[model samples]
Target: MADNYKQYTSCCQAKDWVSLSAYLGFAAAGLAVVWIPIIALAGWCALFYLLVAAAAAGVAACRWWLEVRLVCLGGDRSAIGMLVSSEPPADKSWPGSVDSDFSMNLLPYPALPGIKQADLELTSPYGFLVAEQAGTKQHVGFFTGEKATEKNGVESAILHAEFEGAGVRDVLIAVTVALGLAIAALIACVAIPPPWGLIVAGILALLAFLAALFGTLFGSGDHGAPGDVKGAPTEVHDNDPVTGLGADLLYVYGTWVFDSLHTGWNEIHPIKKCTFVGKWEGAWPADIVDVQHRLDAGFADARDPATVSRQAEDRFTWAIHPLVDGCGEAVDVPAPAQADAGLH
Candidate 1:
């Protein structure tokens, strides 16, 4: 898990650097076109300053955005629910089933004051959260789940969304728009003359059209697939016991120990029903004997049976080591009798 996280971080950093480089290069080139001919040496110095400043700001923004996405998607389980509550309400019914369409406001973290309430549209059970916060309906994240939950005494459905490919798509769209505008401005600059202006405008128009075509092609990468990446678990499942285990386990990568861990599987209540939301990756396991074995191993290693019991009392809980993969397969090895002998 540590190695996988490090690799993912490195990949994200490399992507950020590449994006920053491209933006800075274009900005520098454009500034040079405008300022170089008028004031050569001075313009060069100014361009250097601009490049440094722009790069710093751009890279900073990129990193911040990445962090926000990570926190929103990965770190905090309740982030989506919190985000939903922060925004003003809209008159729309929650979809009867996960298969139906729905709309909701997506709010960014309180720290990100610049980010406005994003009006998100859910198309399918697994589609990106479309936000029009920046005056455009853009794909922001994947809709993970929604459940009725309380936040600061207010009752609402807590929505879960993950922003990975959606973030890349956002960057692509921003770059395309910026490039289109730059191309337009360049055409205008060339249109100061007569017959030459007509020729230049026609050529510029052709270039602009080609640029748009290329942008569309480039931006249309696969942003829909959720579980394509390894390590990042996209699926959620309810691993209810078929035998004598009294408590229900909401299993994703590991068994999710929620506050309602003591709730019976057949209980009909709002809290129990909303405690777990979203679709399972595949069919539920015929027997979670392997899962229980793995959990027992983990508990034995902890040397505190009480700690495992305490998890049920907590509002949120995750395993010290995830026992399952993205595909709902157990990955942890069961402890040997000798290892468990001393702990017991």
Candidate 2:
């Protein structure tokens, strides 16, 4: 897994260089368009200022897209979680390459279950786990499990990492190209000295400038916090507990909430959403069972007005209390009920 991750990291670094080179090429080409005119009309000092401003804008735009927007909006609500059926292999095969199943749902998409027995070698066993969507064969989020020594009779696994989507790279490339073309057009106007050419170049430059400015300001989403997406670690929790049925169990899970849903400047009232990832078995937690019961009761009493009202009240209280008080812990288990005094 470590080797595989290292390889992937190398690949990403290479890809970054490729992207940087492409952007630089575009910037150079754009500068060539206006180089002659800027030197002839504006003199050396003006030309220098123009070059510096363009470079600064280009750098700022790149950083804004890669570091800010991509980090925040790239996969804010997407994650990978694994549930291993049994202990992993002893050999140094893939760490999380045990007999396991992966399930994931990248917001606005339904939950997808991966194939039970697929080619593991073709898949990423470490770093980011990629699973083929059941029928479509499209790769979804990363998920994997690894062997772990029992700590106080409890076994656990943790996985959290950032992934860049194709969209981020595509947008960056488009902006770079646009800026380049705008410069080229302006140079053509200066060299040719045609009214039509100048008009066209001016339009193109304005459009490109607007695009860069807008993307930098509102590309990611509203309320995009730099620290939130800048290599921030995902939160995870796990523990071992004994159920009333005498079944020992180990559970692991995590949750993530997006900082903002707004994807554009005009967007308002963005849909707020969160994702939950975990693995559990046998008897579920008491709180989960209780919530299910309450929801079911609410459905059953839907025909009665008074019962419906009471159920709504209970549900609201249960749901809002955690939000109001701030749920510091991952999972909260209600205390066990006491037995009746005369029952025994």
Candidate 3:
């Protein structure tokens, strides 16, 4: 975002586009615009001044356009809801079924270091309230009544949820457009009728050039971009539960990557979703005894695997079904332990 719109700042600092555009549009529409009169009063000597002023105006307008703030996403329970449940429920869990599933890999912030989880607010467009911690990978596990096994060891059941994108790569297309416009403006400025036209065209060209350059450079949706390089899968691990409290379940571990681009300040941008599969277990052993209490009654309808996949819904509820038959003697170790003894 910084690189993409950096040029606008120079233009804006030179002059106020808001005031100038208002004046130009007003002048174009016949207002008692002061700049035109000032330029006119000064005669041919002030033509250079007029071009500078017009350029300033263009910069200001572009600033206003590119300063779009990340949209506000809401849902008080979204933070908690995302933490505790994946699919919505039908009712609280009964003896026969589970109400909600658990998501353990919800990083409350972006992958950028030094960023606080408290500073990142969850938003509707963001899809989920997750922290994008640096060097973290999301992991998923199944609940098989006895033990949940990863490639390393037996563990509890947990699902890791990560957000890919909201169709933001469309911004790249926008950047390309802006670049094209800038090139055209540059060409027109060189070939245009008068000095004033050239300045206006030149100003437009500069803004377009900045938009294109930055839009493509930092517009990527990859969480680890512009920093340290890592080759492991992107999903984070949800800690395993106590030993022996096992149940039978299926786990799907994967990573979600976002391809994004920024166009203008107020313009709506789309995001693209790309997923990388890591590990998949069809019938593994695990436990949801402790987490089971948080499931909202009847939350399964929203998280039903069939429904979850059908709607292409990114944020929804899920169930944590604890198969009664899979249980073994409960291990008296810590409640929520991360990974096995040997994992680095």
Candidate 4:
């Protein structure tokens, strides 16, 4: 997240109270922890430095969520594209929160000029070994971007996953806090009425000073502040074979968003489940089939509607279905505008 925390809250749109509250919480906590030394060390003069330190802490917490690496989301859109290669694993540039991160290049349908199938970044948050069994290998399935739609103005297909804050932000936090604590500790040696008062201040200041020092070394946990980000490992196996193919395609049963604030790529973050629909041959028929619709007025689930491979795109191991194209036949495209007139 940027200094303003916009990267974290971009997907949230106007509903950013969660992030705001976190910022305030961290700042208040930092201030409260060292308030005694804050006054004992520099009288009222140190308030300015303390405020600055708190602000830095607040910004870090808002960005990293105490190193929790929670991904906020937004929007929902379906895309049909070809999975070029298969069985890719998480790269070196992955955040600690991501586990068994599987990604493959996708050439999104309604294919953009230069854009490939786009990156289908999947994670094994549950229990799905996608790198081995997502059927994610070389298939043209209907993928629903849980929180993103536009192929991107940049035309980049890599799924967005990095937080800008986790980078230089750590350096900033470490340097700021260390400097502030050091100054306060040094001042405590000279000021603070000597003897017992000075002793207490020295002890407190040393503990705080040491904390600031070790915190940078230990890492960011309390809101991902002043250190590198790391997380526990997780796995992926086929427990729910629905989300990996992409959720929010036919029916959006959850809140999903593009999460443009951090990384501006369309991603399914924690993939729910995925099934191997079929291999991607070539371009799908522009009019493949609307198996889920074209039956009554529209907007209803259908089963095994595939008279052709294109129509077969709606195969969901679960009831949640997919976006199909009209191929090899004229679409039974029903009129939705007259849907109010009752099914014929």
Compute each candidate's TM-score over C-alphas: 0.28, 0.28, 0.24, 0.33
For candidate 1, the C-alpha RMSD (Å) to the true structure equals 18.8
Residue-level lDDT of model 2, residues 32-53, one tens digit each, is 5756557566332332335334
The weakest ten consecutive residues by lDDT in model 2 span 1-10
- C-alpha root-mean-square deviation, candidate 3: 23.6
RMSD of each: 18.8, 18.5, 23.6, 19.3
- Mark the regions of model 1 whose C-alpha exceeds 4 Å error after superposition: 3-156, 166-193, 217-220, 231-344
- Tens-digit lDDT string for candidate 3 (1-344): 10110011111111222332454464344322634664565444443443344344443333333332122112112211111112212232431111121222322211111223233333322223332312111211111111123322433222233222211242434455664565456445545667875777767766765665554344332122111113322333322334322212211222232111122111011111112222223221133222322332223454467765865532222233223432333447767867797877
Better structure of 2 and 3 per TM-score: 2
lDDT over C-alpha atoms for residue 258 of model 3: 15
Best by TM-score: 4
lDDT of 4 by residue, 124-197 (tens): 12111111222211221123332223322223232222222233245345546655655555466556565754
How do all the candidates rank in terms of lDDT, highest first? Answer: 4, 2, 3, 1
Indicate which candidate wins on lDDT: 4
Q: Residues 1-344, candidate 1, lDDT per residue (tens digit)?
A: 11111111111221222233444566567755765554443322232333333333334444433332221111211211112321111122222111111112122121111221122223221123222122111222122223322232333222233222333334444445444544443444344465664555455445544554454344344232223334333332222223212112221121111111111011111010111222222223433335444544543444465765655542324443333423333458778666665585
* Residue 123 displacement in candidate 1 (angstroms): 30
Comparison by TM-score, 1 against 3, better one: 1
lDDT against the true structure, per candidate, is: 0.30, 0.33, 0.30, 0.35
lDDT of 2 at 102: 20
Please tell me which model should have the higher lDDT, number 1 or number 3: 3
